[model samples]
Target: MRRMLKQSALVRDNNFKGGLKEYAKEMGKIGKFATQLKIAGYVSIATDIVGSSIKVYEAAPEDKARTTVVETAKVGAGIGFGIYASYLIVGLATGGTGLIVIGIVAAGAAIAAKGTSEIAGYGAGYIYDKVESINE
Candidate 1:
């Protein structure tokens, strides 16, 4: 009977140890799954942020220039007129109508170039502000 009892206790101890090992293994798998799920969640959020930024950029006025002829013409005319007028005054003081015309044309071209650059800068700033606001 003593030998039988000792054998029973040994069997119980072995079973308990085996169960603990299995539990630990299962917990490890759960931990790995949890970690993967967290990584996936982070990736999803990052994708969403990028998608939203793209949407905002696409919706902006600068991006719309490709499709909006009237707005483009208006901006072109305004910049040309404003910059040409400034340069024309200087050209008139130094030369005649010929120089004034040349100055106007040159100023219009320069303004067109600068206007494009400013629009790009403004678009970038708008996107930055939008993203910052979204994060907040």
Candidate 2:
């Protein structure tokens, strides 16, 4: 009985070590991919900014176009900041995990951040519109 217990303990230790080694190797791969993912994210943001600017220019009248452009820029900045802040917070919260795990958590955080920001912006805009109408 004693010999059997010793052998089982040894097996469990070996399995744990093997699993940890595999997890480390996967994390290394995720690290390499993270660089590429970051580059893609930057490109995506630039594309969104340019596209939004073009739409604002085309849609707004001549007198309002500049103001629309500025407002669009503000919105973009807010979204960018929100995403970065959320990412930082989530990264800190998941400090002990691999990049893949961090990415997953950060993505969820970013999505939630974006959604909440949009809702807040819409609510503020609605309130401002109502107040302006009441003043008029």
Tens-digit lDDT track for model 2 on 1-136?
Answer: 5456344433245423445455446546656666665775677567656765676766647435444534464466556665676567446433435455666765665566556546655665566567667988
Tens digits of per-residue lDDT for model 1, 30-77:
456446544643564455446445655667685453323323343444
Best by TM-score: 2
**Segments of candidate 2 deviating more than 4 angstroms:** 1-27, 62-74, 82-94, 98-100, 120-124, 127-136
TM-score of each: 0.32, 0.53
lDDT of each: 0.48, 0.56
Candidate 1 global CA lDDT score = 0.48
Q: How does model 2 fare in lDDT? A: 0.56
Residue 111 accuracy (lDDT) in model 1:
59
Q: Against the correct fold, how does model 1 do in TM-score?
A: 0.32
